[model samples]
Target chain A: MATFMDVHRGMTGITDEQLREAHAADLAIQDEEGVSFEHAWADPDSGVVYCLSEAPSPDAVQRVHERAGHPASEIHPVPLAV
Target chain B: MATFMDVHRGMTGITDEQLREAHAADLAIQDEEGVSFEHAWADPDSGVVYCLSEAPSPDAVQRVHERAGHPASEIHPVPLAV
Candidate 1:
Protein backbone atom coordinates (compact mmCIF):
# COMPACT_ATOMS: atom_id res chain seq x y z
CA MET A 1 0.00 0.00 0.00
CA ALA A 2 1.09 3.60 -0.56
CA THR A 3 0.81 6.39 1.97
CA PHE A 4 -1.16 9.48 1.09
CA MET A 5 -1.72 12.83 2.76
CA ASP A 6 -4.91 14.69 1.99
CA VAL A 7 -5.86 18.22 2.92
CA HIS A 8 -9.26 19.77 3.60
CA ARG A 9 -9.70 23.50 3.86
CA GLY A 10 -12.38 25.96 4.98
CA MET A 11 -13.23 23.97 8.08
CA THR A 12 -13.13 26.90 10.42
CA GLY A 13 -14.76 26.55 13.85
CA ILE A 14 -14.75 22.77 13.70
CA THR A 15 -14.43 21.04 17.04
CA ASP A 16 -12.35 18.09 18.14
CA GLU A 17 -15.44 16.01 18.73
CA GLN A 18 -16.71 16.76 15.24
CA LEU A 19 -13.43 15.74 13.65
CA ARG A 20 -13.35 12.50 15.60
CA GLU A 21 -16.88 11.75 14.53
CA ALA A 22 -16.00 12.36 10.89
CA HIS A 23 -12.94 10.16 11.15
CA ALA A 24 -14.97 7.41 12.73
CA ALA A 25 -17.51 7.63 9.95
CA ASP A 26 -14.74 7.28 7.38
CA LEU A 27 -13.30 4.29 9.19
CA ALA A 28 -16.65 2.53 9.17
CA ILE A 29 -16.75 2.52 5.38
CA GLN A 30 -13.06 2.75 4.45
CA ASP A 31 -12.68 -0.95 3.85
CA GLU A 32 -15.28 -0.80 1.10
CA GLU A 33 -12.89 1.42 -0.85
CA GLY A 34 -9.68 -0.38 0.13
CA VAL A 35 -8.45 2.55 2.18
CA SER A 36 -7.26 2.71 5.75
CA PHE A 37 -7.10 6.02 7.54
CA GLU A 38 -4.12 6.10 9.86
CA HIS A 39 -4.46 9.47 11.53
CA ALA A 40 -6.21 12.82 11.28
CA TRP A 41 -5.22 16.30 12.41
CA ALA A 42 -7.17 19.51 12.38
CA ASP A 43 -6.31 23.16 12.82
CA PRO A 44 -9.52 24.96 13.66
CA ASP A 45 -7.73 28.29 13.52
CA SER A 46 -6.68 27.83 9.91
CA GLY A 47 -9.64 25.75 8.80
CA VAL A 48 -7.38 23.00 7.59
CA VAL A 49 -7.73 19.30 8.23
CA TYR A 50 -5.10 16.73 7.26
CA CYS A 51 -5.54 13.00 6.96
CA LEU A 52 -2.84 10.38 6.54
CA SER A 53 -3.89 7.06 5.11
CA GLU A 54 -2.58 3.93 3.48
CA ALA A 55 -4.46 3.02 0.33
CA PRO A 56 -4.23 1.31 -3.01
CA SER A 57 -4.24 4.71 -4.71
CA PRO A 58 -4.97 8.37 -4.06
CA ASP A 59 -8.31 7.86 -5.83
CA ALA A 60 -9.30 5.28 -3.24
CA VAL A 61 -8.54 7.70 -0.45
CA GLN A 62 -10.57 10.43 -2.11
CA ARG A 63 -13.45 8.04 -2.66
CA VAL A 64 -13.59 7.22 1.01
CA HIS A 65 -13.48 10.87 2.00
CA GLU A 66 -16.11 11.84 -0.55
CA ARG A 67 -18.40 9.10 0.64
CA ALA A 68 -17.93 10.35 4.18
CA GLY A 69 -18.98 13.83 3.06
CA HIS A 70 -15.59 15.41 3.70
CA PRO A 71 -13.93 15.47 0.32
CA ALA A 72 -10.33 16.64 0.46
CA SER A 73 -9.18 19.81 -1.26
CA GLU A 74 -5.84 18.28 -2.18
CA ILE A 75 -4.32 14.82 -2.20
CA HIS A 76 -0.67 13.81 -2.59
CA PRO A 77 1.31 10.65 -2.34
CA VAL A 78 3.79 10.58 0.52
CA PRO A 79 6.83 9.12 -1.10
CA LEU A 80 8.94 9.34 2.03
CA ALA A 81 8.35 9.46 5.77
CA VAL A 82 10.25 9.82 9.02
CA MET B 1 2.71 22.00 24.88
CA ALA B 2 0.45 22.59 21.94
CA THR B 3 0.66 20.68 18.70
CA PHE B 4 1.37 22.61 15.51
CA MET B 5 1.27 21.55 11.89
CA ASP B 6 3.55 23.42 9.49
CA VAL B 7 3.61 23.26 5.74
CA HIS B 8 6.46 23.92 3.31
CA ARG B 9 5.94 24.49 -0.38
CA GLY B 10 8.12 24.76 -3.49
CA MET B 11 10.36 21.94 -2.39
CA THR B 12 10.44 20.25 -5.77
CA GLY B 13 13.35 17.88 -6.45
CA ILE B 14 14.16 17.62 -2.76
CA THR B 15 15.15 14.16 -1.63
CA ASP B 16 14.09 12.10 1.37
CA GLU B 17 17.60 12.12 2.75
CA GLN B 18 17.62 15.91 2.60
CA LEU B 19 14.35 16.12 4.54
CA ARG B 20 15.61 13.71 7.17
CA GLU B 21 18.80 15.67 7.54
CA ALA B 22 16.88 18.89 7.94
CA HIS B 23 14.59 17.27 10.49
CA ALA B 24 17.54 15.98 12.46
CA ALA B 25 19.12 19.41 12.42
CA ASP B 26 15.92 20.85 13.80
CA LEU B 27 15.84 18.21 16.54
CA ALA B 28 19.35 19.06 17.51
CA ILE B 29 18.35 22.63 18.32
CA GLN B 30 14.65 22.25 19.11
CA ASP B 31 15.14 21.91 22.85
CA GLU B 32 16.79 25.30 23.01
CA GLU B 33 13.58 26.77 21.65
CA GLY B 34 11.09 24.59 23.55
CA VAL B 35 9.95 22.68 20.46
CA SER B 36 9.79 19.02 19.68
CA PHE B 37 9.33 17.70 16.16
CA GLU B 38 7.05 14.70 16.14
CA HIS B 39 6.98 13.60 12.51
CA ALA B 40 7.54 14.76 8.94
CA TRP B 41 6.02 13.81 5.59
CA ALA B 42 6.89 14.91 2.10
CA ASP B 43 5.18 14.71 -1.29
CA PRO B 44 7.85 14.76 -3.96
CA ASP B 45 5.26 15.18 -6.67
CA SER B 46 3.56 18.13 -5.04
CA GLY B 47 6.60 19.77 -3.43
CA VAL B 48 4.85 19.96 -0.11
CA VAL B 49 6.31 19.04 3.27
CA TYR B 50 4.35 18.72 6.46
CA CYS B 51 5.79 18.75 9.94
CA LEU B 52 4.01 17.97 13.18
CA SER B 53 5.50 19.35 16.36
CA GLU B 54 4.77 20.09 19.97
CA ALA B 55 5.90 23.52 21.04
CA PRO B 56 5.26 26.35 23.46
CA SER B 57 4.23 28.58 20.58
CA PRO B 58 4.09 28.69 16.81
CA ASP B 59 6.99 31.11 16.76
CA ALA B 60 9.15 28.63 18.53
CA VAL B 61 8.37 26.04 15.89
CA GLN B 62 9.13 28.50 13.15
CA ARG B 63 12.41 29.42 14.75
CA VAL B 64 13.50 25.83 14.74
CA HIS B 65 12.58 25.43 11.11
CA GLU B 66 14.18 28.70 10.14
CA ARG B 67 17.39 27.73 11.84
CA ALA B 68 17.27 24.45 10.00
CA GLY B 69 16.90 26.43 6.78
CA HIS B 70 13.55 24.97 5.71
CA PRO B 71 11.10 27.66 6.75
CA ALA B 72 7.48 26.66 6.53
CA SER B 73 5.02 28.50 4.35
CA GLU B 74 2.26 28.13 6.91
CA ILE B 75 1.85 27.10 10.50
CA HIS B 76 -1.39 26.26 12.28
CA PRO B 77 -2.29 25.09 15.72
CA VAL B 78 -3.67 21.59 15.67
CA PRO B 79 -6.51 21.96 18.12
CA LEU B 80 -8.07 18.60 17.27
CA ALA B 81 -6.95 15.08 16.60
CA VAL B 82 -8.27 11.59 15.90
Candidate 2:
Protein backbone atom coordinates (compact mmCIF):
# COMPACT_ATOMS: atom_id res chain seq x y z
CA MET A 1 0.00 0.00 0.00
CA ALA A 2 1.05 3.58 -0.53
CA THR A 3 0.17 6.81 1.14
CA PHE A 4 -1.65 9.48 -0.88
CA MET A 5 -2.59 13.07 -0.52
CA ASP A 6 -5.74 14.04 -2.36
CA VAL A 7 -6.93 17.57 -2.90
CA HIS A 8 -10.54 18.66 -3.25
CA ARG A 9 -11.18 22.09 -4.66
CA GLY A 10 -14.18 24.44 -4.54
CA MET A 11 -15.24 23.67 -0.99
CA THR A 12 -15.76 27.24 0.05
CA GLY A 13 -17.36 27.95 3.44
CA ILE A 14 -17.02 24.36 4.62
CA THR A 15 -17.81 24.02 8.28
CA ASP A 16 -15.99 21.89 10.81
CA GLU A 17 -19.06 19.74 11.34
CA GLN A 18 -19.42 19.20 7.62
CA LEU A 19 -15.79 18.30 7.25
CA ARG A 20 -16.04 15.74 10.05
CA GLU A 21 -19.20 14.33 8.56
CA ALA A 22 -17.57 13.95 5.16
CA HIS A 23 -14.52 12.29 6.73
CA ALA A 24 -16.82 9.94 8.59
CA ALA A 25 -18.50 9.10 5.33
CA ASP A 26 -15.20 8.19 3.75
CA LEU A 27 -14.21 6.12 6.78
CA ALA A 28 -17.49 4.25 6.53
CA ILE A 29 -16.81 2.98 3.01
CA GLN A 30 -13.04 3.22 2.61
CA ASP A 31 -12.47 -0.39 3.63
CA GLU A 32 -14.26 -1.58 0.52
CA GLU A 33 -11.55 -0.01 -1.58
CA GLY A 34 -8.66 -0.96 0.69
CA VAL A 35 -8.21 2.65 1.69
CA SER A 36 -7.88 4.33 5.05
CA PHE A 37 -8.65 8.05 5.24
CA GLU A 38 -6.38 8.93 8.12
CA HIS A 39 -6.78 12.68 8.25
CA ALA A 40 -8.03 15.73 6.37
CA TRP A 41 -7.49 19.48 6.40
CA ALA A 42 -9.31 22.33 4.79
CA ASP A 43 -8.78 25.95 3.89
CA PRO A 44 -12.26 27.18 3.35
CA ASP A 45 -10.95 30.48 2.14
CA SER A 46 -9.11 28.81 -0.68
CA GLY A 47 -11.94 26.41 -1.35
CA VAL A 48 -9.47 23.57 -1.00
CA VAL A 49 -9.43 20.46 1.16
CA TYR A 50 -6.69 17.89 1.46
CA CYS A 51 -7.08 14.30 2.60
CA LEU A 52 -4.24 12.01 3.57
CA SER A 53 -4.74 8.28 3.30
CA GLU A 54 -3.16 4.93 2.71
CA ALA A 55 -4.45 2.84 -0.15
CA PRO A 56 -3.42 0.24 -2.65
CA SER A 57 -3.51 2.89 -5.33
CA PRO A 58 -4.54 6.44 -6.08
CA ASP A 59 -7.71 5.08 -7.64
CA ALA A 60 -8.65 3.47 -4.36
CA VAL A 61 -8.28 6.77 -2.55
CA GLN A 62 -10.33 8.57 -5.19
CA ARG A 63 -12.95 5.87 -5.06
CA VAL A 64 -13.43 6.36 -1.34
CA HIS A 65 -13.71 10.12 -1.67
CA GLU A 66 -16.04 9.94 -4.65
CA ARG A 67 -18.25 7.46 -2.86
CA ALA A 68 -18.30 9.64 0.22
CA GLY A 69 -19.61 12.66 -1.74
CA HIS A 70 -16.50 14.78 -2.42
CA PRO A 71 -14.38 13.77 -5.37
CA ALA A 72 -10.79 14.91 -5.26
CA SER A 73 -9.37 17.09 -8.00
CA GLU A 74 -5.84 15.78 -7.62
CA ILE A 75 -4.59 12.51 -6.16
CA HIS A 76 -0.84 12.33 -5.64
CA PRO A 77 0.84 9.14 -4.49
CA VAL A 78 3.13 9.69 -1.55
CA PRO A 79 5.62 6.91 -2.09
CA LEU A 80 8.17 8.46 0.25
CA ALA A 81 7.56 10.42 3.44
CA VAL A 82 9.24 11.75 6.56
CA MET B 1 -1.61 28.64 15.47
CA ALA B 2 -2.80 27.13 12.21
CA THR B 3 -1.95 24.03 10.25
CA PHE B 4 -0.46 24.56 6.80
CA MET B 5 0.15 22.42 3.77
CA ASP B 6 3.03 23.56 1.62
CA VAL B 7 3.90 22.32 -1.83
CA HIS B 8 7.29 22.23 -3.50
CA ARG B 9 7.50 21.66 -7.20
CA GLY B 10 10.15 20.57 -9.69
CA MET B 11 12.15 18.23 -7.47
CA THR B 12 12.12 15.51 -10.09
CA GLY B 13 14.75 13.14 -8.76
CA ILE B 14 14.59 13.62 -5.02
CA THR B 15 15.68 10.49 -3.21
CA ASP B 16 14.45 9.24 0.14
CA GLU B 17 17.70 10.24 1.77
CA GLN B 18 17.43 13.76 0.39
CA LEU B 19 13.88 14.06 1.55
CA ARG B 20 14.84 12.98 5.04
CA GLU B 21 17.77 15.34 5.09
CA ALA B 22 15.58 18.27 4.05
CA HIS B 23 12.99 17.38 6.65
CA ALA B 24 15.67 17.16 9.30
CA ALA B 25 16.93 20.57 8.33
CA ASP B 26 13.46 21.97 8.69
CA LEU B 27 13.09 20.26 12.04
CA ALA B 28 16.38 21.68 13.20
CA ILE B 29 15.11 25.22 12.69
CA GLN B 30 11.32 24.97 12.92
CA ASP B 31 11.22 25.91 16.58
CA GLU B 32 12.77 29.24 15.76
CA GLU B 33 9.44 30.31 14.29
CA GLY B 34 7.26 28.37 16.71
CA VAL B 35 6.50 25.97 13.90
CA SER B 36 6.44 22.20 13.88
CA PHE B 37 7.17 20.28 10.74
CA GLU B 38 4.91 17.38 11.42
CA HIS B 39 5.23 15.32 8.26
CA ALA B 40 6.15 15.42 4.59
CA TRP B 41 5.25 13.47 1.46
CA ALA B 42 6.82 13.37 -1.93
CA ASP B 43 5.89 12.02 -5.35
CA PRO B 44 9.18 11.88 -7.15
CA ASP B 45 7.49 11.02 -10.39
CA SER B 46 5.48 14.21 -10.29
CA GLY B 47 8.30 16.28 -8.92
CA VAL B 48 6.13 17.43 -6.09
CA VAL B 49 6.61 17.49 -2.33
CA TYR B 50 4.07 18.22 0.34
CA CYS B 51 4.83 19.26 3.89
CA LEU B 52 2.35 19.34 6.72
CA SER B 53 3.08 21.71 9.56
CA GLU B 54 1.64 23.68 12.45
CA ALA B 55 2.68 27.30 12.43
CA PRO B 56 1.64 30.81 13.17
CA SER B 57 1.28 31.62 9.48
CA PRO B 58 2.10 30.41 6.01
CA ASP B 59 5.08 32.77 6.00
CA ALA B 60 6.62 30.92 8.93
CA VAL B 61 6.28 27.65 7.10
CA GLN B 62 7.80 29.17 4.00
CA ARG B 63 10.65 30.68 5.96
CA VAL B 64 11.60 27.35 7.45
CA HIS B 65 11.52 25.65 4.08
CA GLU B 66 13.48 28.50 2.49
CA ARG B 67 16.15 28.39 5.16
CA ALA B 68 16.22 24.60 4.91
CA GLY B 69 17.04 24.95 1.18
CA HIS B 70 13.72 23.88 -0.38
CA PRO B 71 11.32 26.73 -0.46
CA ALA B 72 7.75 25.75 -1.12
CA SER B 73 6.04 27.06 -4.24
CA GLU B 74 2.67 27.22 -2.59
CA ILE B 75 1.55 27.33 1.02
CA HIS B 76 -2.05 27.04 2.15
CA PRO B 77 -3.32 27.54 5.63
CA VAL B 78 -5.50 24.72 6.90
CA PRO B 79 -7.58 26.16 9.67
CA LEU B 80 -9.92 23.21 9.89
CA ALA B 81 -9.16 19.52 10.11
CA VAL B 82 -10.50 16.11 11.01
Cα displacement (Å) at residue A22, model 2 = 0.9
lDDT of 2 by residue, A6-81 (tens): 9999999999999999999999998899998889999989989999999999988888888888999999988999
Clashes of each: 0, 0
Candidate 1, A1-82: lDDT as tens digits: 9999999999998998899999999999999988999999998877899999999999999999998999999999988888
Clashes of 1: 0
**Residue A82 in model 2: lDDT:** 93
Query: Candidates' TM-scores?
Result: 0.98, 0.95
What is candidate 1's CAPRI-style docking category based on DockQ? Answer: high
